[model samples]
Target: MTKIQPSAPLRSPHGSLLRRKAKDNPTLASILGSYEKFSTAALSLVVSDKNSVFALVEAFNAYRNEAVYLFESGKNVPQENLRSTMLEELFSWLFKDLFAILQFDQPTNYWAGKATSSYLTLTFAPKNFQSLFEDPNPKISKKDQDFAIGATVAIKVMASKSDDSAPALTVILPVVAIECKTYLAKNHLDMCSATAQSLKRANPYCMYLIATEFLKMDSEVTPEVTDISEIFILCKAENAERKKRQSEGKPPHPMHADVVWELFSMVMGHLRAVWWDPASSLDRGKVIGRPF
Candidate 1:
C-alpha cells in the first residue's frame, strides 16, 4: 500500500505578524467569522428581494460586465465615463422601481427631482404648523438665499395642493437622496453633507446616501459627515488596476457586490419602515396580492 502524503497547512496572504496575531486572538477571529457570516446572510436577503434590490444588483453587474468587455476588446474607454454612465442608469432604474412600489394615492407621488431649500424663504414657525413658509416673524436676509443644490437622484413626494385658483404648490421633499461620484473627495463629501443637512432640516425623515466608485477618503471620514446615512463604494478599480495597486503594496477598493449588498440592506430596511399603510391593510386583504 502506498503511503498518503499530508497536505500543507493553509497559508494567508497577510504578513506573518498579522497572521500570527489573527491566529492568537480568539476575539478577533470570532469577530471576523461573525462579519463573514453576516455579510453572506445580508447578501442573500438583498438578492432575494424581487422588487428593487435584485434589479439594482443586476444593473451594477450589467455595467461591470460591459466595462470588462469593452476593455478586453481593446477599446480606449475612460473608467470615469463608465462609472458616471452606470451611476446615471442606476438612478433611473432604482427610482422607477421605488416609485412604483411606494406610490398609492394620487397626490402622494414619487419622482426624481430637485430639492431646493432656502433659509430666507422658509422659516421654522411654531404657530403655522401646516406650511413651512408661514412664519410670524420672518427674517429675510439682504444677501441672496444660499441654496444647496439638490442631488442627482432625489425622491420627491407631493405634499398638498391648494384650491383651483392657487397654482398647484408641490412640496419637493425628498424621502431618499443619493449623491453619486466616480471618486469621493473631501470637498465633494463636504458638499454632500451640507446638502443632506439642508434637506434633513426641511424634512427630518429624508434618507441621504453617498455612492462612489472609489473611496478616496479614509473610513473615519464617513462618521464625521453626520448628515449622510451611509456611504457605498459601489465598485473598486478595474481588475487590472486592482492587481497593479496590490503589486505596488496598496489596498484595492471594495468589490461592487459587497457595496451593492450593503446598499440593498439599507434600502430594504428603510422600505420596511415606511412602505406599509395600516389603514389600507383591510383593503389589501380584500384585493389579490400583487407586486408593483
Candidate 2:
C-alpha cells in the first residue's frame, strides 16, 4: 500500500492557542491547565535543570504518584484501568488535533509564499494509517487485512482559504507529512533515531507525534537515550489532592513516582506536554489530608 500524506492544512486565525478557542484544545491548552494546577498546589513544580536524567525522573514521579478518575465515551471506566486507558485516549487526541492545526498552517504559508492559485494538492492514507494499531503482522491474508487496517480513516480536503476563481497559487498549498506512533519498547534516544530514519526516508519536514512516556516498559524495552526534539511526550501530571495531603500522615498513593519509575526509568526528560482536566478539583471536599 502507498504511504499516506496530510491533506490541505486548515486555516485558523489564531496560533497554537487555537485549541483554547475550540471547545477542546487537548494538546497545548489542556496540558498547560494541568501544569497550572501543579504550580498552584503544594509541591513546588519545576522544569528541567542542568541534569536531564534527574529532571526526567523527578517529573515522571511527580505525575505518576497521583491517580485520577477517568471518563470514557461519556462514561467513567473502572478506577483500576482508568489511568491506563485514559493515557492512550489522551495521547491519541493530542496527536489528531495538533495535526489538524499543522495541516492548516503549512498549506496557508505555502500558498502565500507562491502567490499561486486556489486548488490544493492533497495526499492522504487509505485508512488514516490505522493499520499500525491493528494486526502486528503486516503479512496477513486478504480477509485479515481489514482486521489489520480497520475502517478507512479519511482525511478529507476541501477549500480551506481560497475562492474558486483565486489564482492557482492563491489558494493552492503544499501537502503536510504527519506521522503518529505508539511506543511500547525502546529508549528515548533509540526511538528518536528510529523515527528520524523513517521521517528522513519520507520527508524531514514531517510532523511527528509519539505517544510514549519517558520510561516505556513491556517487550519493546530498549536502552534509554535522549534525543526527543521532534517527539512529543504525551503523559500525565501531578495529582492535585494527593500532594496537599502528603505531609499529613496520609501516605502517598500506591502509584507514586517510585512505583511507576520502578519499571520504566527516567520518564520526565522526554515529557513535552500533559493532559489535564481541572474538573478533578471539584473533588477537593473528598480529599483526606490537610492542604499545604
Candidate 3:
C-alpha cells in the first residue's frame, strides 16, 4: 500500500487583495503608530505598579472562579450576567487607572462600561467604504437591530456641542465596541464576527473586539471576519479539568498577564490616537508625530 500525503491548505482567491487593502488601511496605520513606544510605555506602567496588575489579575480570576462555582453548583445563573460583571470590573481597572499611567495628563470625562443605548448610531456617513452606511433615519428592523446586537461594552469620549439658540450639552459616540463571552463557542464567534463586520462597515475606524474568559474555539483566524481587530482569551479553564479529559489535553490559551498587557496597550493606543491632543502635549510631555 502506498502512503498517503496530506493535502496543502486551501487559500482564498482575494488573499492578496485583502493583504494589500490591509496594508493601505489608513485607519489601521494611524491607530498602530509607534508600536514600540506605546508598548514600552504600557509595559513600564505594569512593571512599575505591581499593585494595580495584581488587583486586575485577582479580579479576573475571581470573576472566572465565581462563574465556575455558580455553574457547578447547579444554579441558574445566566452566563451573560457573569460576562457583563467581569467586563465592567475589568474596564474600570483599565480606563480608570492603568491607562492613565501611559498618558501625560489624565483624561477627563472618558467613559468605559456597559452601553445603556439600544443601538450605537453613527453621526457621520462612510464616504469611501461600501460596507457600512449612515442611515439618517434609522428604523428598528428586528427586535434587536443588527447594529446593536452583541454590543456588550462601550468606550465613549465626551464631546460638547453649542448652537446659537441652545446651551451646550454633552454627547458621545461609541468609539470602541466589545463583545464578551464566557466561553467563546462557534455560534458566539459567528455572532461577534457579524457584529464587528457591521460596525466596520458603518465606521471603519471603530475599534472592535471579541473577548472571552475561556477559549473554546479553534485558534485559526476566520478569514471572513476581517473587521475584528483582535480576539482576546483572558484565562484558561481549570488545569485539572483539562487533564481529566482523556482525549483533549491542554487547550491553547494565552497567559493572563500577556492578555491583560496586550489589551491595555491596545486600549491605550486607541485613546492616545483619539482623545490625546498632540499640540497641547497634555499628559504626554512632548509631541512626537508618527515616524512611519
Model 1: per-residue Cα lDDT over 125-216, one tens digit each: 33555554332333321111111112223222232352333323334445566676766777888887777677666656566777777666
lDDT of each: 0.45, 0.29, 0.45
The parts of candidate 2 lying over 4 Å away from their true place are 1-37, 40-48, 51-60, 68-202, 205-211, 214-292
Q: Write the per-residue lDDT of candidate 2 for residues 197-283, one digit (tens) a residue.
A: 443333222222343433344445433342222333333322344344454645444322333332122222212222133465465
Candidate 2, number of clashes: 18
Once fitted onto the true fold, the runs of candidate 3 whose alpha carbons sit more than 4 angstroms away are 1-51, 62-67, 75-80, 102-109, 118-172, 219-225, 237-255, 274-292
Ranking by TM-score: 3, 1, 2
Off by over 4 Å in 1: 1-59, 65-83, 99-108, 113-171, 219-222, 236-255, 274-292
TM-scores for all candidates: the values are 0.48, 0.25, 0.51
Pairs in steric clash, model 1: none
Q: 2 or 3, which is superior by TM-score?
A: 3
RMSD of each: 18.4, 20.0, 19.2
Model 3 Cα lDDT, one tens digit per residue, 1-292 = 2322212111221222223443665532332233223222323333224455555455445434423333233355332243244444444334444333554543354444554452334354333454233222223211122111122333332222322333322333345666666567777777777766665565555677766666566557572436677877776564334335423542333238667667666755664563425776766675643211
